[model samples]
Target chain A: MRPAGFLVALLLAAFAAAPASAAFQYYVFREFGVAKEFPLEPTRREAEYRTPLLGRAVPATIFETTEDNMVYRFTVADMRAVDLVARSAGLYAECIAMAEAEGKVLARMPQRVEDGTAFRVYGQLTSVDLAEAGGRKQTNCFLNKGWLYKVESIVLPARGEPNAAAALRFSTSLRFRIDQAPDSP
Target chain B: MRRIAFTAAAVFALFAPPLAAQEHEPLEWQEYAYPELGIAKEFPASPQRQTGKYQTEVVGENAVPSVVYFVDFGDLIFQMTVVDLRAPEHVLRAANILAECIFLAESAGLPLANLPLDVKDDTQFGVHGRVVSVDLNYNLGVRQTACLHKDGRLYKMEATMVHPEEEDGEAIARFVTSQRFELRKP
Candidate 1:
C-alpha cells in the first residue's frame, strides 16, 4: 500500500508540472452559422469583426492556440441575398493574384474536402533569417455559402514538429452549415 | 609435361594483352575577384512644406527610383516616378494610359483581378486595383493607384496590397481617399 501511494503521488506531480495544452474551440452562430476556435493565448484575441466588399459584415472568432505555432480563425458570413458561387470565385481569383505579386510560391494546390468545401494552402519563404523561430509558412483556406465567403489564414514556423502538428489539428476542426445560427452556446 | 606447359603459356599470351600505361596530370587552378556594385546615390531632397495631406521621402534613388509616402492613415512605397506634369488636362489621361497598360499586361496571361479604376475629380486622383495572379486559383489582395492633384501639377502612381484579411474593402477605400502627393523638384 505504501509503494502504490508513492507511485500515485509521483504521477500527479509530473502531470501538474507539465505545461497546459491549447486546443481550438468550435462554435455555431445563427446569423453566420459555423466557425472554429483558434488556439491563441487569449480567448478575447480570437474574436474580430470586419466589413467586406459590398458593405457586407463578417465576424471571426478564434478557437485554439498551441506551442506548435498554429492559430485557427473561424469566420461566419451572411450572404443569403447574393450570388454565392460567383462572389466566391471572384474573391478566390483576387486572392491568388495578390499572392503571386508578393513572390510567394505555392507549395500545395487547392484541394476540395469530402464535405464540399474548397481550400488552398500556400507556403512563403522568409526574407530575413529566422534560425531561432524556425522558417515561416502561411496557409489560407476559403469557404463559401451562397454569397458569404469565409477566409482563414494561418502562419506557421518552418521548423518544429509541434507547430506542424498543431496546424494540422486546427485545420481538421473546420465545419460548415447553411442554417443561420449564433456562434456562442 | 614441359611441352604441355609451353602450350599453356602461349595460349595465355594470346588471350591477354599487356596492361595499358597510366598517366598523371596536375590540376589547373585560377583565382578571381569581383568588383563591388557601389551603393546608389540618394534623390534630391524635396522642399519643406507647412501643411499637406501627404508627405514624400526619398527612400532610394537611382535609374530605378523608390519613394516612400505617408498619407493620413497609412504609408506606401512607390518604385516609379513622382513627377509634376505641367498640364492639368493631361493628369487624367496619363492615369488612364497607365490603367490600360496594366490591363493589357493582365490580359496577356498576367494574373491581375478585381481591377477597379476610378477618377476622383474633387481630389484629382485616380484609383486602380491590381493583383499578381498565382497558379490558376490563388491571388494576393493588392491595390494600385495613380494620384493626380486637383491643380494637375503632381502625379504619383503606386501599387498596394493588404495583408490577408488585415482590412476590408471599405477601410481600404477610405485609406485611398485620404492620400495626398508631395512632388520633388527634378
Candidate 2:
C-alpha cells in the first residue's frame, strides 16, 4: 500500500478501535510561528486567501487532514501590505463574517495572546447529516504581526463530546513565538 | 421622574439660544492630560470626570471600567471617555474595542459622514480609529466623535455643537486635532 493511504488506513483503524485516543500528534511549524495538535498528518500546500474588503487575494499556506468524517484545516496567510493594524481589524471582521456564513454563530469570545489578538467562534453548519446529529464547526483565528492564523474543525454532530474535546485540544495547543522578529520569512 | 427630567432637558436644549444669539466669546482651549490614563486631549474648559462601566459583546457578563471627562458649554459640549480593557479576554483586542466605541457613537445619532483615522500613539503599533459625524435625534445638535484603542484602553473624544456656525469650525478642528495618546512607560 502507498505510504499516505497506509497512514490513513492505520488512522481509521485506530479511530474505530479508540475514537477518543486517535493518535493525535503535536506539530510545531516554526516557520509559520505556530504549534498545534493534529489527529493525522496534514497535507501542506500553497494557496491564495481572499480578503473581500481588501479586494484581493493574498498568498497563504494551508494544512489539512480528515478522519472519521471530521475535517481539520489550519491556514497561515501573509498579508503583504502596509498598515496591518487597519488590515488586521478588517481581517478580524472578515473572519467572523466567514464563520457566521457557515451557519448560525452559537458563541464568540475574544482572546488575547502573546503579541496578537485571537477570536474563538462556534457555529452550527447549515448542511445536515443523516447519520449524525448535525454538522458543526469551530474556528479560532489569530492575527499576529502581519500574519493571520486560522484553525478550523468541522465535525458531525454524532461525534459529540469527543470531537469537542479534540477541537479544544487542537485550538488551545496553538502557540506563537514571543521574541520572534516580526514579519520574518 | 426620569422621563420628566429627560423631557425638561430636551425642552431646554430645543429652546436654547444659539451661540451667535448668546454673543459668547470664543472659548478658551486647554490640554488635559491624565498620566494615569496615559491620554491627553484638548478641552474647551476644565472637564468634570465620572467613572462608569461599558458593556460589549466580547466582554461577556463582566463590565469593564470606564472614565469620562466632559465639559458642557450649553452651545457646544466636549467629552472624552477612556475604557480600561486589561482583562485577559480583552487584551490586545484594540480593534474590537474601537469597533464597539464606533457602534455606540453611531447609535447615538444619524450618521452623516465618516472619515477613517490612524491615531498616533507612543507605541510602535498605533491605533486604527474613525471619526463619525452624526446629527442627534430630537434636533439636539450635530456631534462629531473620534474613537480609537491604544495600550488596552479605548479612547473616545466627542464634540457636540448645538448649532455650529462657520466660526465654530476652528474650535472643533482644534479639539479633534489636538487629541494625542502618550502612553507612560511601565
Candidate 2: chain B TM-score equals: 0.78
Per-model DockQ: 0.01, 0.05
TM-scores for all candidates: the values are 0.32, 0.48
lDDT of 2 by residue, B1-186 (tens): 999999999999999975453355468788877888887788878889999987775444678899999988778778888888766456544445555565566777787755556555675545455677788888887888887665567777888878766677677656665676754532
- Which model scores highest in lDDT? 2
List, residue by residue over B1-186, the lDDT tens digit for candidate 1. Answer: 999999999999998875332221221212111111111112112211122222121111212222333222122212222333223223322322222333333333324333333332222222223322211224433454433322323333333432323333333334333332222211
Binned by DockQ into CAPRI classes (incorrect, acceptable, medium, high), candidate 2 is incorrect
Q: Tell me candidate 1's interface RMSD.
A: 15.7
Give per-residue CA lDDT, model 2, range A1-185, as digits (tens).
69999999999998887755657776777776676678888889999988655456888999988877677888888864664444455455456456655664555433444434333222112121223334777777666545677888777665664346666556545666424433312
| Two-chain DockQ for model 2 | 0.05
Please give the TM-score that candidate 1 achieves against the real structure: 0.32
RMSD, one per candidate, in order: 21.5, 15.3
Interface RMSD, in order shown? 15.7, 7.9
